[model samples]
Target: MPTGVAIRDVREQLFDAAERVLLRDGRNALTSRAVTTEAGCAKGVLHRHFADFDAFLTDFVLDRIGRIDARTGALRGSAGTGTVADNLTAALTALFESAAVAIVGLITARDELRARLRRDLPAGVPVLTEAAELVAAYLVEERDLGRITADADVDTLAAMLIGTAHLLFADRFGTPPEAEGVRRIVTTVLVGVGPRP
Candidate 1:
């Protein structure tokens, strides 16, 4: 909102405020006014940066997806440092802890926003698919290091992990699975994939 401030900085601030509102008060509470008020900016600031509320929402969700993808990508560097199951649990845990789950409902509730995202993003795959690919790549790295079995189906394993993360994060009544629970899920899935003793 301030003069001479970078647009990226302003957008980041708005995004952070929006995420806080969504996480604290749920998806319905996320409004331009709410985000601006939380960000300490003028009510018009959101509209100034985005064409409309739907656009802002689309951007916000996409931003979160980007972050999730980046986190999965970073898992490559940690390939052999920890137990493969532990490393995967850590990645899945990070995805669960993100605002992705909270915003997913918001995106799905509005068809227009969802359509807009599909239009803006590449036609091939959604962000979650890309995330799955990242996980598969990490699994491959582990297999190459002899951490996991060579015959493991990394693609199927990646999809299973992503689905598990979605289920764990989407739980409304119960607390989401913690790191230990995630580790358990990963270990269970890797029963055939992990190296034999």
Candidate 2:
């Protein structure tokens, strides 16, 4: 029925609007009424899709992580195809860019959501660890292929890149890191660990 279609459309709109509210205002503003208002729907619409606020919040957090994972997968396909530093910078930047604000908001509210995220969601740690490990493997491969300096400590350098990304995320939300700011950090890490050419 046309009414059914309209209701489905409105539900989709509400879900998206909730994400925007979470991103902009953090967890404090993610009430059911707020989401419905943002979606221009009545309060009851939220319960039609989601059972409760906690369920909605749980799904929202997982959805955000899934989005970032998909973005990383896309970036990986194009990685190592360009100049090493350029590709590495692009890959790493893609990992952190849009998710920075959301991540910062989540981290700042970790005390409230940490236990729930831990219990309900698979921690993103494995994916993050895998990413860093792949970076190390790539460095070792490049060195073996004579594309990079032989002396670089691949794992250490990979860890440094990952650690620096965390710092950059913090800086981005707290102080609004500039283009030059990110470039400086990336270039510094690459210069120390990347190929001489």
Judged by TM-score, which candidate is best?
1
lDDT of 2 at 28: 72
Q: What's the CA error at residue 158 for candidate 1, in Å?
A: 0.7
Name the weakest run of 10 consecutive residues (lDDT summed) in model 1: 122-131
* CA error at residue 131 for candidate 2, angstroms: 6.5
RMSD of 2: 4.2
Per-residue CA lDDT of candidate 2, range 28-73, in tens? Answer: 7778888888877777767877777766666666666666666655
Per-residue lDDT of candidate 1, residues 1-197 (tens digit): 67656555888999999999988888779889999999988877788889999999888888888888877666898998977887888888877777767777777677888789888775423556666788999999999999898899999999888887777778644687777888888888888887766
What are the lDDT scores of the predictions, listed in order?
0.81, 0.64
In candidate 1, list every pair of residues with a backbone clash.
none
Off by over 4 Å in 1: 1-8, 122-127, 172-174
- Global lDDT of model 1: 0.81
TM-score of 2: 0.69
